[model samples]
Target: MAESIPSDSPAVADDHHGHEEPSFWSKYVFSTDHKMIAMQYMFTGMAMAVIGGFMAYAFRMQLAFPGIEVPGFGIVTPANYNALVTNHGAIMIFWVAMPVLIAAFGNYLIPLMCGCDDMVFPKLNRLSYQIFLLSAVVLLSSFFVEGGGFGGAWTAYPPLSAKAEYSLTPLGSSIWLGAVALEFVAFLLGGINFITTAMNSRAPGMKLYDIPIVIWMIVIASILFLVSVGPLIAGAIMLLFDQQLGTAFFDPARGGDPVLWQHLFWFFGHPEVYVVLLPALGITAEIITVFARKKLFGYKTVLHTTIATGVLSFTVWAHHQFISGVDPRMAHVFTLTTLLISVPIAEMMFVYIATLYGGSIRLTTPMLWGLSFIAEFLIGGVTGIFLGASGADIYFHDTYFVLAHFHYTFFPIAIIGTFAGLTFWFPKMFGRMMNDRLGKIHFWGTIIPFNFIFIPLFVLGMGGQHRRIFDYSYFPELSMPWMQDIRVLATSSLLIMLGFQVVFFYNFIVSLRSGEKASKNPWKSNTLEWTADSPPPHGNWKELPTVYRGPYEYSVPGRDEDYWPQDQPN
Candidate 1:
């Protein structure tokens, strides 16, 4: 059972012993180490999240109190409002969600959990972050450019996005497209790295079934992104050419169908939801199983369901096009596929619940987050059924209902899932336990206001309030006092949610500096990562672990301990 495992290279050994300590630049900034790179991606993504949140604040303030000078930001102009909405969507999805859920956690956890010292291609991993960083820089720089940022929205639908005259930001539009394209390329690289490393590198005896769910989820997500992103990248290039060169790929007057871009975008776009979502779901799975002190119910079922979800994701992209005048038969096909895709997701959620049943459940902050993900995301899933049906979507299309459904879904995937993962792994990542008291405070603060924020949007959407309206005063029907009152409620709820994030940040900083010192295996779980140091070193372990059992070996009969470590020999 104690077979020899691969050790770090001589160069790594020399750096630790024979050579001097690494400088700040080499150690933290441009390091080829996967963990450092993950830190870089995580922090960068967090910073972008703050920017995205501020954008939400700015735009929501405008919606709640039109023409009023917002604090921190003065009067929000029409262009400013559009840019805020557009970039907020783009940054949160691409910059924040993908980076944190996939790149950051994927990079950090894959190698460590897999019991390898580093990624298969460490330099390539570093290069991926560099490209991602450059893409972010390019995106932010667009806002300060000659025409301000692109206001064509995150989807960048054609006619508006393809034509400079319509978008009013020739340079900004092109730069935005370019930034998005570059970001895809970076992920393409990172995805390849994740897939290859997970496939190739594992400790001895760690069979396919023995691998952690988080690793599988990240790898599967990488595959989904790889398959789906190509068409959008091509469409982005074509859109760029239309904007800069004399092309009409998406211009109706020039014989190019604008809806063609919709096909290319949503084809990737719908699956993009699952791409981020799979990782978040995987994170919740880890948290739930650990805190509940139970074996994951139907682990293989979850795996198979995830794969089915990915396959079905491609078929459902056309649902977003139902209201775009797509062929009714095609819409019907997509509608069926859209509803079908939800089955696997719902199955995974049920599997989690089954795991929690009759188990010793701990109400830790991370567990609360994990449980809330299931609850909140269930709302998103159920609401999505309305949008999935072509007939219902025809009424709900482009309304605040769609917006509310989207937020309900994505808020869980990106924000709630992220917090769940962060809190669960805080000790492993930082070698210190986060303050549970503060964590619970922050959790309730965020969750309560969150429901308040979007539930009203669903109501407003049902009332036929258009999502894109800068101000509703012009429309007498929408300007009704009740409608405006709902808008204010949503916006005020957002402010409270944003305000509570302060508690999280304070808790994070204070805990990082001086928190309770944590020992290895703080969670006492079965995953291989727990066998290593609290904050594992350059070569994760003095000797790499050889797996002996599956990850979730809890409550095995005849043993005093309820939990079993994967590497422990009987």
Candidate 2:
């Protein structure tokens, strides 16, 4: 057998020397153990996902039934509806997706995958999760405050988000800003840990190439976030001052430029898209190659293109500002950059396709989600080109088209990518196999309903139905009977999608206790995490693993087994 991760490796031995078993609270609640902390991130993100999903259901009901009473929540007032919209976007991206995708998996997998015992800054890692949890609680608490959650949308644009009078939220706006500022701080701290650990803590033989694609992508994402998020942090502070202290940094009435905030926000905002996206792509990459039983085609090419994509993301933020009255020349420049950014992304897609061609494909549950991500993300990416052209954006901006574009992009990134990673890593994380049959059922239910909900928005958007309103009853031309039909269909599909997740959640909970116990190398792959115990040990390995080859070394000629592990001493 080609076994690799030792149960008694020297490095693990050295690190755990004189290590004591943690008490229950220390182990589960406040431990510096990366694995335990990962569970914390996962559980918290899942909780927030429920909150964000309910907000979506609330607004979708409003859209479909038009002033119909939402069941748990009363009739969605215009402000309440807007609050749902704003908080849904903000919570999913900041609280749910960022933590699940970046913090949860990044902390869990990076140390193990990089052959390190723990993050370089273990205390800081715990602090990041603490801050992240606090951010979530603070934002959720905004719902009960004097005015209700801030309705200014996630962007928190200047004029509306500037003054509570326009927004109708005295305390909500500042609380929202405070919550988001805390989120930025958490990610900044976590990003430092991710980058430092990857650079300095790899095992002796694990070269840059030997590092798995997922770890590399996470490191790149951390760097991208660190560089891109600074201006937004500063901008958020200015917005805070403008809101509470009446400083008017973004208030045009007080000699502040509203457009300046847009510039600062989108500058970070654009890169922020890829900060989550690169990890999604990376997770999908790992799953695809593993299930297909093939070496990742163009691994180095994907890496270089990822770097190129990060660089290009900075230049394209103005695409979101087309209607903000940017000069025509700058619009032209942004349009070109926006379109150019797709090339690298498209090239990476080609690499994924090439990786699967002529290989034995598995189509497992994780594979299903990975494949869905490629197909759906492509649809989302392609539709974005129309909006990227500044001329077309004049027509499409803020319409259902833009809403559709983002949901297609981010829904796949946030939902599908997370689903794929969750399914892929379930065995390693929990020491058991999730129900594959149930997993496939969840996959179909999710992807089909997902497409049904958003695909029609392209039609509605091109037809010129605007987004973010409580009702379109007055827009007779736009609110045709067919419009209601599609709205009903989309809303119904969303409900169906939510229903499917019930299966996943049930399976997840039950399987944790009773699922088939997994072996150390369940999928029989080469990654170091697999070489550890199925759920891994406190320190991940008994001794640090010495990597002998690249991550994804599968199907060498004359090899008896189909998979070639990196630590396999041939």
Candidate 3:
């Protein structure tokens, strides 16, 4: 149950009653505090990112310099190369990106932004992380199983993934399926808490519109995840039964349908894109409005468009099925909806651009990342049109063009957008300022090399370079000696971008102990969380903040200060 704040206490003051301070274990580990849990998610996700990043490095090294001995892994074999590719895609999406972007901020920000003490189901929230941690362990263990890690692509398409006889790695495949299933369970539990907290536990007198757009996005995303994940979970279970117990749900020899698995996987898979994307969009929206010193343009329209996008996401999963032997007529339907889905996204992007027009812009570290997300995601969204159309997709189907498009989308949202939120809320999270100068340096280092790495993939893709091929030198048709330079270039850009993150991590850690102490509401933005202590107390507020207006009030005429906090009396 949500705690009731006493009537007489102010929002910012502490110490209504005396209580002993908890030990480190109780306060930090095994705690139900949302902020602590969020921190746990961030660190754990970063650890997973290290694992995922290494996999990408190994495979990229293999492609750029085939059979070269890496320091730890030795010369990358064909089987080993496949593992790196499969685990890189799987770990980055499921373990690193989703947990960091969705579960991390969803736990940390939802209650605070919605004006609550902690999640309504605090124990369930804690268990979700514990389960997620176990899932990570299980996934890592698959690397050691019999024939090496399962590598039927991240899509895990069957007959290849379904039959151990065909895939030739029985135990690893089964465990991978199990890990993915466990992850789904963890998020499902977390998603329920998000929706319930936003709906039932909002601070009194705060109407739906008074809620921050970030909170709205998280709630809607949770709903989409909950509704969409069911089929995939069912699909995974059936696949597991086939692999371990020989049920043959996807094996055609046993009268099962391989295309059925694609439908199930992609049904959840398409909305799953927004599951990872919308919260980052929420973070960028908040940062942009604050830095630009303006109200969010078309707040109601943005809200409605968000819901529309969620609905539209469901209809376009079959776009992935166009070349997969589906009915061409049905292909036309999916293509139409896939292209149409971009309209709402384009509207939201233009709104951000319009919000920045003639406003007092702060070129802060966070704003740079927010702007990078817009710029990068625009490229991603535009390129997706080519793949959305059946005619164009048949040419670009499994090429690096698709790879470039998705990396543009997921990297910006998960990496760039997450960076923005991390920097913008660093003070709020830690009660200290991150070094703004170092942050700007880190931002440039990441964005420039990121573009260098992925943009050339478009050219290589246009040159008919296919994805997941370990060596291209064997083929005479692809044997342009100069084309290998593109592979080397992308690999070099990856290493450089990774080097910058060391600076980011250093700034994040050092600033915690030695940086400038923050005042309450450092950004002076209009949000209830800003009404509390910088690192809010265990229960977040001494008294709940009563709402007065929307969260984006800025630059109004006759206001002495440009900002008006949401807790201030109107």
TM-scores, all candidates, are: 0.96, 0.97, 0.96
Q: What TM-score would you give candidate 2 relative to the actual structure?
A: 0.97
Off by over 4 Å in 1: 1-20
Q: After superposition, how far is residue 273 of candidate 1 from its true place, in Å?
A: 0.2
| Per-model C-alpha RMSD | 3.2, 4.3, 3.9
What is the lDDT for 70 in model 2?
91
Query: Alpha carbon lDDT of residue 63, candidate 1?
Result: 96
Taken over the whole model, the C-alpha lDDT of each candidate is 0.90, 0.89, 0.88
Q: Return the number of clashes found in candidate 1.
A: 0
Model 3 scores a TM of 0.96
Q: lDDT by residue for model 1 over 1-570, one digit each (tens)?
A: 112333354211112221247888888887878888998999999999999999999999999999999999899998998889999999999999999999999999998888888887676788789999999999999999998999988999989988778889989999999999999999998998899889887888999999889999999999999999999999998998999997999999979999999999998998999999999999999998999999999889999999999899988898888878778789878878888887998898889889988789999999999999999999998999999988899899999999999999999999999999999888988999999999999999999999999999999999988876788899999999998899899999999999999999999999999999989988878898888888888768888889899898888888999899999997
Ten residues in sequence with the least summed lDDT for candidate 3: 10-19
Please list the residue runs of candidate 3 whose C-alpha ends up more than 4 Å from where it truly belongs after superposition.
Answer: 1-19
How well is each residue in 172-198 modelled by candidate 2, as lDDT tens digits? 999999999999999998999899888
Model 2, position 240, has a per-residue lDDT of: 89
> Candidate 2, 4: how far from true, in Å?
30
